[model samples]
Target chain A: MTDIRADIHAQTGASEPGFGDYVTLLKPRVMSLVVFTALVGLLVAPVALHPIEALAAVIFIALGAGASGALNMWWDADIDQVMRRTARRPIPAGKVEPGEALGLGLALSGIAVIMLGLATNLLAAGLLAFTIFFYAVIYSMWLKRATPQNIVIGGAAGAFPPMIGWAAVTGSVGIEAWLMFALIFMWTPPHFWALALFMKEDYSNARVPMLTVTHGRRSTRRHILAYTVLLVPVALAAGFTSIGGPVYLAAALVMNALFLHGAWAIWRRDEARAEADGYRTEKQVFRLSLYYLFVHFSALLVEAALRGTGAYALVGIAG
Target chain B: MSTRTTPLRPTHELHKRRFSRNLGVGLTLVAFIALVFGLTIAKVQGGGTLQAYDHTFRPALLPQDD
Candidate 1:
């Protein structure tokens, strides 16, 4: 049977996709970040939720984010086929059909939104619905192919999860929630542009009009430095909010310094020198950007857990 | 002599894929049902409010700490 199946596969040259292939269509790595940030947002809020309710909220939020990812892959299958990075996605790799992806995305979007409304509150569900629309229709279908400022504007979709999580618990938006939103919003440019710096050809070949492609690498480096300079203050400002404390402030200070220094190094290096060193500084900054967000969010969680305890005492601004 | 060349039903990769998809859907459905049940229980356990509009003092609406 194995021999026969091997011959069948060799003859057909078709991918025998399994259930996992469909799961991959959801962009699980990105969904994990959505889950993490949403969970942190829910946990940090003043209102407490039943564990069951919180679990349901986080799961539905993850589902909503995954559905948007499926919609993005469905819409971008053409460009996914072009770029080496996304070329192996389920749709482009021939493991899934475009129409199937679209149907699944739409169906899951509906289910997630309605179920979240039932599980949490309408405000959270409404935010999730808008996020899906923003990512699928606004960003994926329109801005991604049309503008160089694509990520600049489109970063809102990724920034909204924590806000949704906050609304889920409190049935409203608050300043602390927006502070988390701003953290991700500002961090996105430097993070993605860093990836684009190293992966320039991929975006250019796909004609995605990324900053690195449209504005040129030198300008891209300058933008990275500018955004990093801008990001530092936004990150530090969170420490003054009700959710902030010594731990969060300390994490924000150290991470922002490292991030800003890396951006400065990237800005100082010339194309000739960057090429000589194989874009090491750009790549390092890209890797650091991941940890930078992780550390900030983790610090928020720590501060929330420490609330009302002696250890939670003396937040610089909260006090 | 038994006339058997291929098995009655030859195993195929498509069958495996189909089985996995069906299993995933089935498990997900079960999980969804369980969640709805759990959510309902949690909501009920949270204690219902006295009809705010009616303002009738329903003893049942109050927490049973006494």
Candidate 2:
């Protein structure tokens, strides 16, 4: 026990971390995506919210997302230290103590849930609380180390933000909200799989059961193509929903075609070719996936804007 | 008994910085929480214009005009 404590203490350096390190522990990059998607969900809803109430809801939701990040970092610090991509994270870098992270996470979780409940509605608050628990306890603790399907099942936590946002505005979940959730859920696998293909060594060293580590690269490649094909229909289908407009349809069509091409390129590559080219196709697809989600969400926002200006009515797509 | 002088421990600046920053963060969070709670209370009381804000905040909570 003393040896283990010493090891942990060493990993969490004796030097005190600055404010920025604490922010890093919150996984700001991931939080940004959560914030954007949640905002889109809230804005695209038919109901309008007071500016202050909307601001509070978004802040609380962002805090809930950050809370999940801190807890995940606290729990995964050991493996994080072993993975090259994660080794420099605040906890693994010895900048923040694991205990501090856990405390911050729990505190923020409580505050976010209660505040969101007060600011929005009980339903939105409940969803936020569930999302935090799902990510921190279910995904981080249970699934991450247990199975190769971790990303597949765990993607639900990330997918909940937009649903929660919709709930915040409308005080209920709807088919449209579920469609947005499904979009993220389906996008996660191919996106993470692409990263895994390029960073298989990190997962191998950390002994995490990522698909690329458990199954061979060939299998992982095929999985990406399969998920991408499934994702295309969902993306296109969303363009026909109430939120859908010509802008979204055009964006979805072009993006899905490019996404399919990227996945196909990846599927056709062998380990030898991939290694020779430094996993270029896989890396390109991974980057494209980021833009893919952002563009889709942005198109939704554009449709919302057009609706606000009555252009959607004139276009007869305001349903 | 022979007396030996112990070296003075050096003060770490990083610790001081972290302490102040964390304090600031703690206070900010507390203030935000207080504000949210206050808004909630005002909402529950049906406080004038604020009640309209609450009504719009959750339209499902209000009676809908079919």
Best by lDDT: 1
Report the lDDT tens digits of candidate 1 across residue range A212-271.
Answer: 888899999999999999999999999988889788999999999999999999999988
TM-score of chain A of 2: 0.95
For model 2, how does the per-residue alpha-carbon lDDT over A1-319 read when each residue is reduced to its tens digit?
A: 1454445447555656778788888899999999999999999999987766777888889999999999999999999999999999998898788999999999999999998998889999999999999999999999999999999999999999999999999999998899999999999999999999999789999999999888889999999999999999899888888888789999999999999999999999999999999999999999999999999999999988898889867867545
Looking at model 2 chain A, report the run of 10 residues with the lowest lDDT sum. Answer: A1-10
Clashing residue pairs found in predicted model 1: none
In model 2, which runs have C-alpha deviations exceeding 4 angstroms?
A: A1-14, B1-12, B19-23, B30-66
| Segments in model 1 whose C-alpha atoms lie over 4 Å from true places | A1-16, A308-310, A313-319, B1-4, B8-11, B50-66
Task: Give the top-scoring candidate (DockQ).
Answer: 1
lDDT of 1: 0.91
In candidate 2, what are the lDDT values of residues B6-61, reduced to their tens digit? 43322345446667778878987797877777666656564443345335455445
Per-residue error (Å), model 1, residue A290: 0.1
DockQ of candidate 1, scored on C-alphas against the true complex (2 decimals): 0.40
Q: Which ten residues in a row have the lowest lDDT in candidate 1 chain A?
A: A310-319
How does each model score on TM-score? 0.91, 0.86
